[model samples]
Target chain A: MNWLTWRQHRAQFLFGAATLAVITLFLVPSGLGIWHTFRSTGLAGCLAVTGRDCGDLASTFSDRYTGLQFTIPLFMILPALLGVFWGAPLVAREIEQGTHRLAWTQGLTRLRWMSTKVVTLVLATLAGAAVFAFLLSWWSRPFVAASDNRFSFGVFDLRGIVPVAYALFALAAGVAAGALIRRTVAAMGATLGAYVAVRTGIELWARPHYEAARTISYSFFGSGPHPGSGDWVLSTRTVDRAGHLLGNGQSLDFNVLHARCPDLPGPSSGFVSKAPIQACIQRLGIHLQATYQPGNRYWLFQGIESAIFVGLALGLLAFAVWWVRRKVA
Target chain B: MTTPAALTATALGKRYRGHWGLRDCSLEIPAGRISALVGPNGAGKTTLLHLATGLLAPTAGTIETLGRTPGEDPDLLPRIGFMAQDVPLYRSFRVREMLEFGRRTNPGRWDAELAQGRMDRASIDLDQRAGTLSGGQRAQVALALALAKRPELLLLDEPLAALDPLARREFLKALMEGAVDGEVTVVLSSHLLTDLERVCDHLVVLSGGRTQVAGDIEGLLEAHRVLTGPRRDVDRIEGVAAVVQQATTDRQSTLLVRTDGPIIDPAWSVHRVDLEELVLGYLGQPNATALPAPRLARTGAEVSR
Candidate 1:
C-alpha cells in the first residue's frame, strides 16, 4: 500500500522537493555573504555593547539586507500551494474520474486505503515544510540578532515552527474540502478561501488576546527615547495623573491656549515644533499612557499560536476521515 | 457433500433516496452454469448484480453469495470477480501495468500464467496504454483481468452491450471457453433474449423492479404453450392455468398460457414455446398480477438439481 501511494503521488512529491531545493540554492550563498558582512563591520561587537550606541551600525545592516527582507512574505504562499496542488487533488481526482470505484473494490478496506494516502502525503508535507523553515530561519539569523524584532506578523509566521503547523493545517483543510466537495478544482478554490480566512482571522482578533498586554505611563519629552523598538505598541493616548482616560481635545484646548499665550507658535507658522506641544501638555498635567506586548514574550506567543493551528489541523483531519469513510459514495 | 447455490437472495431489495431500484427480489442461481438475466431498461437487473458483487448493500433482506454475505470481507473478495458496467480501467496505465495492478491488489489470489495466456491469445499488445485501445480490445483486456482472479463465481454486467456483432461473438466465445474450462458459475445481464438463447441454460426474467420469470430454460419453455383457435373466451378453455397473453381478431383468438395438464380443447392448436417467446411473454406484461400468482412462481430447478 505504501509503495502504491508513492507511485501515484510521485509527481507531486517531486515537484515539492524541487521547489524546496531551488529556494535553498537561492538563500544559502546570499545568507553566507550577509553573515560575513555583519562580522566584518563589527556590528555584532557594537550591538553587544548594549547601553553605549550601535544604532548607526544596525541601520547600515538593515540598509544592506532590505532587498532580501522583502522576500519574506513569499514564503507564506508555500503552504497555500501545498493545499491547492497536493491535497485538493488527492481524493477529488479519484472520485471525479470514477477511479475510486476501482480503488475501493480492491482487497484492502476503504479506511486503510484512505489512511495510507493521507498519512503518507502529510508526512511528505511536513518534511518539505521542515526543510523550508530551517533554511529561512538560518538565513534571517544575523538580521534578527542585530535588530531583535522578530514579533512582526510576517517575520514571526515565516521563521519558526509555526510554518510547519500552517502547512499541515492547509493540507488538512484541502483534504476535508476535497472529501466534502468531491471535485478537484472546486475543492482547490474552497481551500484557498478557507486558508486565507482563518489566517487573517487569527492574526487580527485571536493573537493579541493570547496574553494580556501591559500598560505603562511616561512623561513627555522633546527628543527622548520612549518604548523599545521591539515592543508591539497596541495604543497610546494622553491621560491625567489619576489615570483617567483623556480624549484628544488638543485642537480646541490648544486654540484657547494660543489666544492666552501670544508667544506660542501660531497656526500660520510653516512648522510647529514638538517642543511647544510637549511643554504645553506637561504643564496641563497630562502623561502618555501606552499599551504594548513586550518582545521577551515572542517564543511563548509563537508556541501558543502553533498550538492553535495544530489543533485546527487535527480537527480538520478527523472530519476528513469521517467524511471519507461515511459520506463519500 | 452438497454445495450451496452460487447465489441466494431472500427478499433482497435496494432503494435509492426513497425509490426502490430493486424490490422484494428472491432468487437462486445454481453453481457451475451460465445463467442469463434478461430485463428491459430499469428493471433491477444491474441492481441485483451489484448487490451480489458487494458494490452495494441491500436495504431490505439478505443476499448470500457462495454462502457468505457480500462486502468488506477479504475472504469473499477472492471468490468473486465482477466487471462493472462500461468496464472502467485506469486509462493512463499500460495494459501490462493494469495486469500488474490486479496482481498487486489481489496479492495471493492472482494467476499470472492464465492472464498472460489469455492476453497473448487475444493479441493484446500489453505495451500500449489502455486509453489507446479500441472498445472491443478494452473489453477483452477487462475480461482477461477478471478471469485471472480464478474466482468461483463471475458476474459480468452488460459486457457485450456496446460491441458490434463480430466483436460480441468473439467476446461471448471467450466467455464460454472460460466458463467451461474453469468450471466457474457466471451471471450475465442483457435485454436481448435471442442473443442468450444459444449459450445460457439457466434463465431469469425481470421487469418493473420485480422478477417475472426464473427457472431452467428448458423447463420454463416446456411449461408454456401458445394456443390459436376460433374467437373464444379464455376462461372457457379447460386446463389453462393462467393466460399470459391474449390476442383477439374478428374470427379467431391467439392465447399464450401456462398449463398444468394437457389442453383438452380439440378446436385449438397447441405449439411449443421457445426461449425468446417465453421471455417476451413475461416482458410484455410489466404487471405480473394479471397472471396467476402460483404459476408465476419459479421452481428454481437448477438450485435443487
Candidate 2:
C-alpha cells in the first residue's frame, strides 16, 4: 500500500516540494534585504526601545519591499491550489480513467485504498503548507514587527498553524467534491468555490465570535483603549454618557450637523478645521468605544479556527468514504 | 465430478437512477470451468459481472464468489481477479512498471513469475508505455496482471470487444491455455458468441435485465432443437416443446424449442441447434424462464431428418 501510494502521488509530491523550494529561494534574499535595510537605517535599535515610533523608517522599509508584500497574499492561495491540483485530481482522475477499478480490485480493499491515499496526501499537504508558512513568516517578520495590523485576516491566516489546517480542509473538500462529481475539472472548481466561501464565512462571521470581543471606551477627543498594537480592532463607535451605542456614520445626519454648526468648514473653505465635529461630540459627552480581539487571544483564535477547519476536513473525508462505498457505483 | 460453484448469485439485482440495470438474476458458475456471459448492448451482462467482481454491490440480493461475499472482506480480494470492461490499465506506466504495480499492490500474494512469463510469451516489450501499446498488447498486459493474481475465480467483462479477430483468437487461446489446467474458474462476458464457443464450456445469456438461459454448453445445445416444416401453426404442432423462439416465411416455419419429448411430426425436419443459435434464440425472447444451465449446449453432429 505504501509503495503504491508513493508511486501514484510521487508527481504531485515532487511538484509541491519544487514549488516550496522556489518560494524559499525567492523569500530568503528578499527577507535579508529587509533586515539589512532596517539595520542600515538605524530603525532597528529605535524600534527595540519604548516611547519611540520608527514609523518613517518602517514606511521606508515597507516601500522598499512593496513587491514582497504583494506575494504575501499569494501564500494564502497555495492551499487552494493544492486542493485543486493535488487533491481534486487524485481520485477524480483515477475514476475518470477507470484505473480505480484496477486499484480497488487489488489485494487491498477500496476502503483501504481510499483511506491510505487520503491520509498520505493530507500529511503531504500539511508539510507543504507548514514549509510555506514558515518561509513567508520569515520574509514578513520585519514588516509584521513594524505594522500594528498583524492580527488582520490576511496576515494572521498565513502565519501560524491555521494555514496547515486550511490546507487540510481544502484537500478534504477537493477529495469530497471529486468523489461526488467524478470529474477533475468540476471538482477543482467546486473546491475553489467552497474554500473561498468557508474562508469568507470565518473571517466575516465566525472569527469575531470565537471569543467575546473586548470593548474599551475612553474620554472624548482621546484615543480609545489600547488593545495592543497587534490586536484586531473589529469596530470603533461613539457611545454617549447614557451608554447608548451611537449608530455608525451611515445613520448620522450631515444636515443636522450643518444646522448645529453653521460655521463649520465646507468643501470650498480654505481654512483648516480643527475641532468642530470633535467639539460637538464632546458637548454630548460622546466617548470612543473600540471593540477588538486582543493580541494575546491570537493563539486562542488560531486554535478555534484550526479546530473548526480540521473538524470540517475530517467530516469531508468521512463523506468521501461513504460516497465511495455506497454511491460511486 | 460434482465440483462446487465458483460463484453463486441469489436474487441479484441492481437499480440505476430511474430503472433497473439488472433484476432478479440468479446464477451459479461451477468451479474449474470457462464460462461465457452473453447479452445484447443494454442487457445486464456487465452489471452481473460487476456485481460478481464486487465492483458493484447488488441492490436487492447477495452474490458470493469463492465462498465469500464479493468485496465484503479484504481477505477475499486476492481470491477473485477482475479485468473490467475496456481492460482499463494505467496508461502512464511502462509495461514492466505496470506489472510491478500489480506486484507492489498485491504484496505477499503476487505471482511475479507467472506475470513475467506470460508477458514474455506474448512478446510484449517491457519498456513500452502502456498507452503507446496497441490494443492487443494492452489487453494482454491486463490479462497477465489478472492471471498473475492466481485467483480461483476471474471475472472478465467484454475482455475481447475491442480487439481485432486475430488478436481475439490469440488472447482467448492464451486465456484457455492458462485456465484449462488449473482450478481457475473464468466468467467472460461478450456479445459475440463465436468468440466464446471456442474457449468457454459454461454459458449465461442476459436480456432485458434478466437471465434468459444458463447451462453447460453441451447440455444446452442438446436440449434445444430447430424444427423446420411446411407453413403451419407452431402452436398446433404435435410433439412441440417449449417454444423458445419461432420465425416463418411463406411456406416455411422454423421454431427453436427446448424439449424433453421426441419430435414425431413427419412433415417437419429436426436439427441440432449451435451455441450461437441457442443464445440468439433465448436473447431475442424476453421473460425467459430460469435456464437449467448458464452455458449454451453445443449442437450434436447428427441430425434426424
Assess every candidate by TM-score: 0.86, 0.93
**Per-prediction DockQ:** 0.39, 0.69
TM-score of chain A of each: 0.89, 0.89
- Over 4 Å off, model 1: A36-45, A48-73, A143-147, A219-232, A235-275, B1-3, B248-252, B289-305
Q: Write the per-residue lDDT of candidate 2 for residues B1-305, one digit (tens) a residue.
A: 37898888888899998999998877788888889988899898888877776788889988888888876767788887889888888888999889998987787778898899889989999999899998888888999888888888888889899999999988998898677666889999999999899888998888888777778898878878899989887665566446777889999989887776788879889999999888887766665443653232322111111
Question: What lDDT is reached at residue A124 by model 1?
Answer: 93
Candidate 2 chain A TM is 0.89
lDDT of 1 by residue, B234-274 (tens): 66568766677778999999877777678988989999988
Clashing pairs in 1: none
The sequence of per-residue lDDT tens digits that candidate 1 reaches over residues A6-50 is 767888889989999999999898888988988899987776675
Q: In DockQ, how does model 1 score against the reference complex?
A: 0.39
DockQ of 2: 0.69
Candidate 1: residue B22 lDDT (0-100): 94
